[model samples]
Target: MTHLPEPPAAPAAGQARIDDQAAKLLAAVEEAMRTPTSYRDDSPLPDYGPTPPVQQPGAPAMSQQATDVGRAAMFCGLATVPPGLIAIGILVASEHADPTVIGMICAAPAALAVPILAIARLLRSAKPEPEVHQHFHGNVTQTTTHSRTSGVWAKNINQK
Candidate 1:
């Protein structure tokens, strides 16, 4: 077999004019892109004045009043359970406590509470209450590409 050539022939000598033309065109394009002029309006966009305030919608379900009510209920439950449990022990231990009278004493708070709750509920229901319904829906997708000019330049290129 014939021996292969040691050096590859370069086209740069024969195609010098074409290479120069291509380089000039590339530079022109780069300069144009850097500060575009032809067919491009680079002036600052006409001040449309300050933008109108955007109304952001919050979750309808997570109101401050609802959170307060939930906290209040939790606090009431926590405050009431231990004492009520202890009272049961006291009732059981008292020898003078009649079986019938014990139940009435235990149920007295609840008996008073139920009617007050019912009346409060009825009074609340009686008013022509306003129904507020708010819905917020959105699909957001964001993408960002960044070049760390200073950081990249500061780094040693030879380092692995």
Candidate 2:
């Protein structure tokens, strides 16, 4: 065939080839990348590792700390209501008792509420939070399909 026209000369030094060989190689690389050539779905990647254990504050877990904080707030709220009522009850019940003594009793509960709430907050501060992990996945599918009759019913509701 006359030497096949000298093979049409090679690419000039470093020019990217525009031929069947280059196209095939490029296609192979693209396919390999798209299909995840390293690990299968069941296998873990090189970087895959176990999550670290969490530590809570003051030896309390996240759930327990939150509960303590809630209890503290509840007690504080109870302290407020009772103190107000006690002040009113003291004033209305007797003029013989010293107002200061009654006031002290009412204020005592509120004062106690403060330490409980403070301890709750301290416990709450000791709880641990989860670390976030990020990963990239292609072509996530999130579709829900219903039967044609179901779709028609929805459409009818919308029209109404």
Candidate 3:
């Protein structure tokens, strides 16, 4: 059988270029491995002096005295209902008074209770509270990319 001709040898200059390229790739990989990435510090800076008071919603427009007045009215309305009924019963039992007068007196307390409760709720609606705010910032890097801007640049110079 005829022998196959020997394959042509690679030129020394081409081999040198290949070796150089391999060395560069290996150095780049080594640099990527040796220096870890994504080192960052996040620390709170001190606030100067006293922080300005936080702005808030306006004061409750309603007054406490007004509330107390409403409360007093509610208390009176609740208190008077029982006594008015009792009075009506007493008058009816006496057998000398009209039932219509007793009934009118009994209805007054129930009518008054509505406005008193409404006024109390209105007053309670008027009061105010507090508020707060927050913010944050930082830099970050990854291990896979050997970016020249990062510590990996030092290794490239060392290789040279």
The model with the greatest TM-score is 1
lDDT of 3: 0.70
Model 2: per-residue Cα lDDT at residue 39: 45
Cα lDDT computed for each candidate against the true fold: 0.73, 0.70, 0.70
TM-score versus the correct structure, for each prediction: 0.28, 0.25, 0.27
Considering lDDT, which of the candidate structures 1 and 2 is the better prediction for this target?
1
TM-score of 3: 0.27
Supply the global lDDT for candidate 2.
0.70
Which residue runs of candidate 2 sit more than 4 Å off their true CA positions? 1-96, 137-160
Point out where model 1 deviates above 4 Å. Answer: 1-61, 95-102, 111-160
